[model samples]
Target: MPLRFPIRPEGLTSGPTLRPSGGPNGAPTYEMWKRRIGASLARRDEWKESVIRFFVELRGERVITWGAEEMQQYFDFWVNILYSNAKILLGHIYFQDPKLIVKKTTDRVIELAPMIEALAQYYQRELKIKRTNQKALINGIITNLGVTKTGYKAIFGEPIEAVDERDEDSIAVTERSLRQMGLLKDEKKGVLDPEKYHELIADERPFVINVSPFDMLFPVGSKEMDELQWVGQEITTFLSTVKNNPLYPKELTENLQGTHIVEMPEGRRMLGIDRDAFAGDEEYKIIRIYEIYDMKNNQFHIIEPTVRDFLHSSANPYEVLDGHPYDFFQPCISPGKDVYGTPLPKIDEAVRLEYVTIRQRIMAHIDKFVARLAVRSDGLDEATLRQAKQGDLGSIIITTDDPNKVFSGMPNPGIDPATFIHLNQLLNDLRISTGISEAKRSGEGRRKTKGEAVLIEKGSDVALSVDQDKVDDFVTGQARRLVQVILRFVDYPIALMFADPGQAEQERAVIPSEDIRAEVHFSVKVGSSQQPNPELDRILKTDLFSLAINPATREALGFQGKAPDYVRMFEDVVAAHNLPNPEDYLVDLPPPEQELEEGEEGGQEPANILQALAGGQQ
Candidate 1:
């Protein structure tokens, strides 16, 4: 039911009845509104009332029913509504005030009152207690003259009653003793060094500027504070367990591996590469794999249970320095080019100095830290390396996520498809930039790789050359072998679609009368605007043309799982030709899928594929 507002009579006689005389409405102001409510109340007995007229009954609730269940539900509904409404009513009472109240109690006057009181108290304390109580007051005559006599003795070498009784003693010099002494030199300056004293200060007082908000300074007090017999007097029982509590750790001692700044002044800065910050650098990547070398055989045999962890930052490379992203004006990894027209030193000179200093420091502390870590690089097993290589990304720790949080400000078609297309274009550009390979082959009896054995019509736009017929014949043979391996793992789309967990439905408030997740199966035809190339089509018809490729290698190999592994190997080699050290970190080569055992039951199609995914890669 809608909350009906009662009519208030002006000028406060305060006795308006349901049928009062001389009202805004002829039937009486309250009476007419009550009648409208009565009509809504009477509609419960009728059957032909329109949905609009019976909205309060149908959409909300009507309290006409007297049954126990109906009565409870109505009461609950009203209570729920009033609980929200009561807060809003109280909010107005707390926040609102009459114009007279606002004008009388202004914030400007209220805020000034305490400050005025403080200033008055300060003046009273400074002026009221002076040398006025001279009628045998111990402090007024005794201590005052004693302090004066001591000061006179200190300056003139004479007692209080000595011959300097007529000498004009300036109160300015005596009162300015704090400023005259070295104690106040920091506030006034020139008492220490007239030329080189630090001008830096808080308001020219020669102090450190712009200190950290967290930094606090306190004077070391005497044992007097300990003498106080307060109830909660803290005992000084604390002891520091860390050896290098402030200055140096045993790990960074000279006997250990110690680091130093390669240079004194880093040109503009005093310090060098900050080791603490360097440890946080996201780009510091490590390859982890376990292998043990045999001194006799001179070969590294990977430990039985071995794995490789490739660490990468989800963040961009240059984002390691907070707020300072590295900019590549003209993107080229080439060593000696114009560097995209910007003249760069052999390395950034600033960074070089910093890095050198960092290396020094790390070496200084290396012996102790490395000694404790139990890491033996010479004896590093594949398993240990692999474990170390994996970036330690802990499980996601989102504690206070709101399941029902909604952002209403997103624009239509919220995320544009152009972004995805742009990203794809960028990857493709870098794909071609490094290197593109084209096989060269003539007639017959050519030297080539084994996998590159395939031959097709020359100069055909769609046909791909497997290898050169001119050189080593290993290319063609390798290409053919690679084709056979791919043919075995060629995957057709699974008949069943993997469920999308993101499609979990929300909880509806009302008991759902219908199921929305019921599958409505449908089929659609996909058509490409361009037609297939005839020569390529013919090539695909061969028994060797089925493409089964691992998804990860396909990305690194720049193929849509179509190109054979032998072809990809050639491409990778050609692309990485310009790299300074190409063999250091190459992508792992996955073995071809093998057939399942003879009597393993419940073996589904793509069992080799599924097993290749799960039974683990060779």
Candidate 2:
């Protein structure tokens, strides 16, 4: 039976009753949330399927359905331009080392910048953020949307077993040992070892996870994620995993049943899971867990609707940025006005279909042009015709007096070169539509001069800058969320490397929980992750060297023509070229007063700037 909603006389419609006609309830039953999730999924099933198809096309898999077998065979040749285009796009967006800039709003938190930036670097390293961003960018390019969930995770170590006080020998030894290790807080109040009692033995840190668009769900008609009433994530895991997870109740997990929904096959197939493998296996059953965050009610829930059970429910545990921990990246701007606007994919459906059509036509043309034999049966005998048809080498054909009538080669039609020209034009169109130029894709430009090539590269960069800006915004948002997690949940002090200005080596610094202030701003350095332009590097080097070598230019630029100034300029040139270990080439120059004293004592000449520059260059 189809579900129906209630329509009022005023011409307004309300969804079906969440609870049964007359069921007692403190909160909406698991069935109600399940239905809500179902409605949200129903609203976006078609859209999600389209995104999935885009991914399928990106993988170079066949997506054409209801086609003739012969035609399908001919269409087997997929030019797979999408794959190459996506690869080039990903390379341009993937950041090697993301430079996160931090600023504090209040003067009181001014000292926290170094610690916070260091912590950001720590999270980037531990979480493998560069790799994560690459994955998200790939998904974003394919589906037009990318998502990341950020939160703090605290993992505690194994607990120490309780020792009975009646066994004085055992109690005494345990208490004394714990006291020596500084784990004991009280002896008489039954709380002997605080570490064992509090279960604070393990690591706690922030985490970021790349979320698939299919796994995420928002309320119907939600234009923006922030304005949504609720959001949910569908997690599929083994039954044992849920049972062993400390967050979910073990009793509920043990009694819960695995999901057997027929509607989930598409999603499962996309994730590369075989449905039949664990269908009826009780021990290895797969559980579908829905983690829903109710922003309006400030509640979080973990439920297994297959069993109609709520495994866990509570107020929002993470009160970080926006009181939720999700950041979204859309590579292309949505064409619609709504927040849930349909994003324009880099390799859209129309482009893929057109490419396949053109390539298949070219294939068909070639197939039709293949040489075939045609002989006159009236002039040639059946055996001779068969032998001629076989066309075997060294087999002489005994033909009639009019050999031309008996055997003749069929005239083959020439394939028009225009067909290939059209195909090439189609390929160029694909690149242009995706904002990828031939030079960017091939990593070479047609320009003869370096300046012209640089100009072309710059033009390509401008075309891709929009997507790059979106990625930067996504990363900046995630960084802010991580900082919030650090401020609110990081209880212990962590040691991290702090990059001090004017210092050759990074210094180790420890940041305690109190030092992480909540009021801070975050942003990524624009284009910090982009591939370096050799022309720009050359220009910078030229300018710096000219300044170092020309005394007049330095004096004009307010640089005191001195040995130390020349050394600084040389270091700047090395840095501009991205050469490692600037310190290795530098010499420890004496202070001017010391140099003067030495000159007076030994009547030595002042340090020569030109020699110092030359030696450093060598």
Candidate 3:
């Protein structure tokens, strides 16, 4: 019998059940969604496959190869337009360096910077392991834009406490062998030191991991911000080997006679449940688990037959990871909207056409070059004629008395001038379609003037700005969700160590309590946002410093205003330059001799101006 998951009793009409008795495959909800997903993917399979093929080509993974049987073969050449375009896009609009901000304003809140730093460290460490850092994020964004037309960066907490027995055993054997050889000191009970032993084991840090778009399946006709009414994945699992493992649900074990099951040594393997649920040494049978998430009517249902198998004897599995809006598997789309975004390759058909045309021209050029050397066949023997077909001999064998009558004149074909022009035009078309100009790709040519360079850069930025904005929004949302996950899940104290803006080593203790987490909000600041243009930064810093002492632009810049927060501005500039903390050098300045402006109540000038004057006098 076909795999069937009954969702309704014969008497029931409709309540919260997914499907009634005559529903799809007798599994009204799951089977229906499965068919929808399969159908939708079938429609997009060609496009998706094309995008993947193009990306692999650009990466040099898929090369065009021809055997000796081929009459003529063209050398595979990819201007790698997609690669260059993605690099530019990432260089400009990738993930911002995240900084956690406490929304509550209190003296005690300032103490939260260390905790915020720790949270940032946690994200960086986790993202790095999962290859979702700034650079990787850019790659994902560009790939999705160029291929899939949508990108995803999922944030889910996973246990980092699992210890690999193989690693542990290897370490133990090494230590024993070293002890026997007397290579290590025997001062303690064991040759291996406690610190060294600890170093070999994985830490107990809970971290988040990313799920690739290829690995994820969503409902058909889904939008980014829309409520994911139904989402699911098929996980693989094993059945228990015990005579009758009470934990194994009868529905799963009995109905696992489906053709899609895999047999294993210890037990049979099936799809839908977690493979890691049992150890290799453990006797178990494999089973599939349909991890379905139904969020209709504000109720999230994690329906699975094996739920009872993995649940604690006294507690339910749902109690552990109950559904929450924050925990919903979210999708982040780039250049996306109410409808799916158009892929870069699809949007630029000219590039594909031009690329194909250029490849043909190159093959023609190669054919012409090969045909340049002609073999005169007038007096050539049978063997000689065969050899001529294989290669160029430079000279022909001739035995005829009248060579001129027997042999015809060899014709030399002139090169096609129009081919070069057409090739160049095609290349230009590729550049226009991708918006990756030669200047950005750094192609060899005449060096551009500063004004020309600026113009080219401006044009590239204009083409990319819309996409960048979309990416920015996506990145910001991901960062915020990650922050929320950290806040909700991570409740331990951490001694986070990081370098301050001044490149000095600094350590801070962070104990994130529910109260602190609740009061905090996250905002992603582009790593280079503060210094959009380095030249502008230098000019502004110099002007601000000069005006600090001259009293000319000081009032205008708010140095003398009621909001005498010049210290904060100075600190920002100092941080940008990686200078030492300003608090250590700060000193209160006596009242200025000049009269104060109306509505300005400050009696003391900032220490920056006094320090500037003192340094000048010295």
Point out where model 3 deviates above 4 Å: 1-85, 92-114, 126-130, 133-206, 223-227, 234-289, 298-342, 369-419, 443-448, 457-464, 490-521, 526-618
lDDT of 1 at 73: 38
- Candidate 1 lDDT over 449-565, as tens digits, reads 223333322332122121111111211122222222111111111111122445543421121112111111111121221222333333333323233255555576575434455
| Top TM-score model | 2
Instruction: Predict model 1's lDDT versus the native.
Output: 0.25
Cα lDDT, all candidates: 0.25, 0.61, 0.43
Worst 10 residues of 1 by lDDT: 144-153
Model 2 RMSD in angstroms: 14.0
Better of 1 and 3 by lDDT: 3
RMSD of 3: 18.8
Summarize candidate 3's per-residue lDDT along 533-576 as a digit string, tens digits.
Answer: 33335445645765665655555656545333467767766765
Cα error of candidate 2 at position 182, Å: 28
Evaluation by lDDT, superior candidate among 2 and 3? 2
The residue ranges of model 1 lying beyond 4 angstroms of the native Cα positions read: 1-276, 279-495, 498-618
Q: Taking the tens digit of each residue's C-alpha lDDT, what string does model 2 give over 529-573?
A: 445566566565657677667767656666544343666677777
